[model samples]
Target: MEITDLTPAELRVWRAFPLNEGVDLRESADDDPADGASWGPGRTVRAEVLRALLLDGPTTGGRVPGLKLTGARVTGRLDLMYGTVDPAMRLRSCHFEKPPNLYGAQVRALVLSDSVLPGLTAGTLRVGIVLRMTGCRVTGPVRLAGAQLSGALFLDGAVLGVPGARSGRPPGPEREDSGERPEPALQLNHATVGTDVWAVGLTAHGRVRMDGATVGGLVNLDDAELHDPDGLALEAETLSVGTDLRAARLRARGMVNLSGATIPRRLVLSSARLSTPAGQALRASVSTIGELWLRGTAPVQGAVNLRGAQLDLLEAAPEVWPERVRIDGLTYRRLSPHLPAERRLPLLEREETGHLPYAYEQLATAYRAAGDEVGARTVQLAKLRRHRRTLPPYARLWGYVQDVTVGYGFRPMRAAGWLLVLLLTGTLAFARERPRPLKADEAPDFNPVFYTLDLLLPIIGFGQEAAFAPRGVHQWLAYLLIVTGWILATTTAAGVTRALSRQ
Candidate 1:
């Protein structure tokens, strides 16, 4: 590039690139390039000059090459598609006239901290070092699809997809509509990052997608706000992470999808306030995580679908529980707070979704593993009651009888109580009237207590029932005693057998 063709700012950048020296044009630290209209020709650097320097600029003998500039206006398109740049590029506190296109390009390090860009298009770009965009304000989508980064990808305190208020520049096109479907504000689909993804305090107006992306280290999104009212706010389906996916204190306005993802470590969402009315708030179905933490004060407005999810531990708070949830095939080895079965039973009692007998059984198993026999029994009894609601009228009637008499085999003491009550009633009734002896020579002594015992115990013979014959009301009383005894004994046996099978 000719020296006459470059502006004063571009000349400075050109002189500093080979020696890795930084060029700051701002008179003061507070002088931002947001008001690019105020910048004269001296502060304007053509994008062609930058591309020229990156591709075939003069090289220093041994000094490291870099392009570090601050507080300038970048004009025209800085298109470096499919090119390989060796220098580290750091453009802090700068304003871009157009979005830099680095599609399929390979670079060393790229840092654009506290800068204002219309958008970014770095799809399939490969970075040898870090890609930091902390405190940046972008007005459109930041596409990084299929990008391979050897170091961390930082977006801490960055704001994207918002209109340019102070810059007076028109915001980038919100969507590149193709086949009627809009693209996401931040797309990292199928990207591979060697280290962590630090996105703390990130605010995006549209969906932030990371579908099928793989990260070697943790992905932290603490205190982030994602708003996509018409669609998903954060769609991370099949996102595999090596460490924890921590998103504590996150506020999302649409559904967050994590279906089919495999996070071997913890998936923490503590203190997240999610709202997606008429849709699911957090749909993590068919995912596998080491642990899932949802214990916080924030409320979730929509249903949570955890069907077919496998977790080692599910640590949740009752206050943050969603009103409706589908946990049909959710298998968690443990639950948090060690709450009683009664307190947790409501989770499985979503009658509008029909009976969840398997869910109740899972809860029972969890309680039993924790050595809470009473809690396990409580869960089992609840399961039976819920199942009874789905039975036919006659079957339900019989179920009611089993429930009242013995708690559907869960309350063994009820059977004993019934037996005591019947024994007392029969003894008192028989004592009031005595039956005549059938034969004076062969009959035993007329003992009312022994006679009542003989009539009530169907399997045993006390020699009193056969020896005496009762008449009138007393005869009818004997018949009633025999029938009642059989009913109680049979019910008690059936209940005991059922309870034993559960154990």
Candidate 2:
């Protein structure tokens, strides 16, 4: 073929060449002496044919190599829609100043790595293939919305600069149908990434939304920084990562909502600081996690909400949590009544010793429940005593004492002594009121008091009634005295005999 300026029609014919039949377009180009520009030294003839090659054919064993398009500036969008490359297509160090659209382009083997795509000013750029951009820098925001990736999407050490600059034409705008209002950066949604995905050390000026993304392996965002107010460092919902989701030192101003997500392995968010509201910090709601390990000294100004989350422990072993787990203001109001008496008692005692009056009040209520009125009264008295001691100086004017007089037995000793006196007085009155009866043979003229004394004198002299009688009574008295003298002697003898026997 002669060296000539190829048109779009001629370029299409070159792309339609059969796989087996080879068409070599290498030719020596004569120098344009008038323009003073060399042509054949580093000129690539196959570069012109690449813009027209519709990749609508099968990529069973296809191969394209030695096709250099270094610093190729495409004015309009270059669409490689539904293109298939079976073998490796080498685009080493190729630069795309304009946006090179590769939407739904399937590649069976390796795509070129380390390709630079800067200032890609196109809306809704999608790469639905095994696209690998290892160490590639995207100067502007690039959207890969709804892109299904089978292989790994490695963007390690890629610098994603802010969108607008001094240039009138800025980067591509985000997708409008993505439900996210106009932001100044890239967004990846519903992107199924197979194998390990690494975007470590990738900087994003604006929000980098990856909602509903699923990664097969570990998704690492080791040391990524975001410098915007509404800048979301990561907003992945239902993000399914296989192993670990290590995101250390990830700073975000807005909320990092990983709500309703399932992390099979450990989800480490160590040393990540957020300076937003309590509602906009780290949120993980209703998430099922194996172990959500958080280490390092990460200061969270906002709340770390993990409500309704279930933590599962598979193995039959003890799990330790050394960190201070505080559940402050966690309301379990329905469970308060159902708490056991033994458990509630300790809490009540803790409150009591802490000088909480409510604890003693509740203890009185508990005693009432147990039908212990005395115990309740005792506790109430103790509370009153404590209140008196803690009163202010001005309130201490009324020096009232609660007289707690305790007696060993039932009544006071003075009351018991009065009862005994009443009993003795009643007995004496009954004895004086009763009439004394005279004996059948005794005279009625006899003085009752003198007769009683005379009867007592004879008994004192050992039953000598004859000695105390008158003349015929006096003669009887003399007889009585003689008999009394003899009886006294006999009685004295018997008393001595009884005393000796008792000994």
* Top candidate, metric lDDT: 1
| Runs with alpha carbons beyond 4 Å of true place in candidate 1 | 163-181, 435-457, 467-481
TM-score of each: 0.92, 0.49
Q: Rate the local accuracy (lDDT) of all candidates.
A: 0.85, 0.47
Q: What tens digits encode model 1's per-residue C-alpha lDDT throughout 52-123?
A: 999888788999889998988888998998999999989899889999999889999999999989888898
Report the number of clashing residue pairs per model. 0, 8
lDDT of 2 by residue, 1-503 (tens): 32245554334334433232223222323222112122232222333345444343222246543222222222345555456534333443334434555555554433334445553332322333455555555655655656666777766666665533311223334333444433545556667777666777666666666777778888787776654445344677777777877777766666677777777886766666655553446666666666565555255655555555544421111111111112221112111122233333333232213445544555555555566655554454455445655777654432121212111111124333432443344334323432233343552443323332333234442222322233333344334434543433344444345335524
Q: What is the lDDT of candidate 1?
A: 0.85
**Model 2 deviation from native, Cα RMSD in Å:** 25.8
TM-score of 1: 0.92
